[model samples]
Target chain A: MGETFKANVIDHFNFWVAVVLMMIGLYAMITKNNLIKKLIGMSIFQTAIILFYVSAGVKDGATIPILEHHAAETEQVEAGEHVEGHPVANHEAHAINPDDYSNPLPHVLMLTAIVVGVATLGVALAVTQVIYKNYGTLEEDEILAKIKAAENDG
Target chain B: MIWQFDIIILIFLVITAVISLRVKDLLAASMVFGTYSFLICLLWAGMGAVDVAFTEATVGAGISAVILIATVYNTRRDSSD
Candidate 1:
C-alpha cells in the first residue's frame, strides 16, 4: 500500500469514458430490434472507433493538427520567433529539436473515414427508402410476416 | 473546471445511452444517440484530437443522424407491442 502507483502517472479518465460509451453503443447495437435504432447503435459504434483513433493519435498538450492557424498568425510573429517549420527546442533541458507538433496523419485518415461514412449513410438511407416502399410498412416484423404469408399462400 | 466538464460529459453519455435504450420509441433513441455522439466528439476535442472531433461532429452526429431520421421517417414511428 505504500508503493507509488506507477500506472497512476497516466491520465486514464478519457480512455475509460470512451470505453464505457463504446460498450454502451455495442450493447445497444446487439440488443435493439428497431432498424432505425440499430442504425443509431451503429452510429454510436462508429463514434467509439472515432474516439479510439483520436485517442491513439493524441500527444500530451497538443493542439489541432491543422496548419491553418500557422498562416494567419505568422504576421504578428517577430524574426526568430516561434513560426511554422522553425527550429525549436525539445521538452528536455537544453536539448535541440523542433517544437512538438500535433500528429497530422490521424486527421487525414479520419477525414477519409468521415467522407466514407457520409457516402455509406446516403446509400443506406436510399436503401431504407426502398425497403419502406415495397413492404408498405417499415416494421421488420411486419415485413417478415408479409413474406411468410406470401410464401404460405403460394 | 476542465475535469468537471469532462466528468459531466461522461456521465451524460451513460445516462443518455440508458435513457435511449429504455425509451420504447426508436426516433427518440436515435435522437438521444445522436446527442451522445455530439458529446463524445467534444470529449475527443478535450483530448486534443481536433480532427477526430471534426469527423465525429460531421459524420457521427450529422450524416448518421440524418440517415437514422430518414430510416425512422420511412419506417414505423413507435415501438412494437
Candidate 2:
C-alpha cells in the first residue's frame, strides 16, 4: 500500500499540484473581501482547471498535435508525382498511430474555457467598476453595510 | 516531458497564485496573476500543447492582464483583505 501510494504521487504529481492551486483559488475567492481580489482568484481557479485538462491530455513521448510532414513525401509531391490526396490521406494509408500525438480534444476545450474566463473577467470587472462608482468602495462588507444603511433610511 | 521542469513550474504556479491572492496591493496582485498565466503557458508548451500555450500567452497573459491592470487603475489600488 505504501509503495503504491508513493508511486501514484510520483506519477501524478501534476494532478496533485493542480488540485492545490484549485484549492488556493477557492480559498481566495471565498475569503477575500475586495472585488478585484475575488476576480483574481477566479482567474487562478480557471487556469488551474485548464492545467488539469492539459495535463490529462499529455502522453509520454508524444509530440504536439500537429503531424510532421516527411521531407521525402513533400519532395515527391513537389516533383510532380501524383499524390493520392492530402497528407492525412497518406497517413491513413500508413496507419497513423494515435499515440504519436498529444490529445487535442482537451486542448480545444480548454481554449474555449480560457476565452470564456476572460470574457467573464471583463464583464465582472465592468460590474465591479460600476459598483465602485456607486458605493465608493470595492469591499463586499462595505457594500453590504451601505445597502443595509440605505434600507434602514428608506 | 521533463518531470523536473514540470515540477518546478508547477511549484512556481502555486506560489504565484498564493502571492497574488495575499498581496495588499491590487496592482501587484494583478501582475502576479499575469506571471501565473505565463507559467501555466510554459507548462502547456512543455506538455506538447503548443497551440494552447500560444493562446494562453496572448490571451491569458497579455490581453487579460492588460484589462485587469486597466480596471485596477480605474478603481482602488489597495485591498483590505
Which candidate gets the maximum lDDT versus the true structure? 2
For residues A1-154, could you state the per-residue lDDT of candidate 1 as single tens digits? 3233434423555567667777877886687655555555565566566656666776755566555555445434533444566755432443322234456676677767767766766776677678778887655678889999999999
* Model 1: CA > 4 A from native: A1-10, A66-99, B1-3
> What are the per-residue Cα lDDT tens digits for candidate 2 across B1-81?
899999899899888988999899999999999999999999999999888899999999998899999999998798897
Question: Model 1 chain A — which ten-residue stretch has the worst lDDT?
Answer: A90-99
For model 2 the TM-score comes to 0.89
RMSD of 2: 3.8
Q: Per-residue lDDT for A153 in model 1?
A: 100
Q: List model 2 lDDT by residue over A116-136, tens digit each.
A: 999999999999999999999
Fraction of native contacts (fnat) of each candidate: 0.57, 0.87
DockQ of each: 0.54, 0.86
Pairs clashing within candidate 1: none
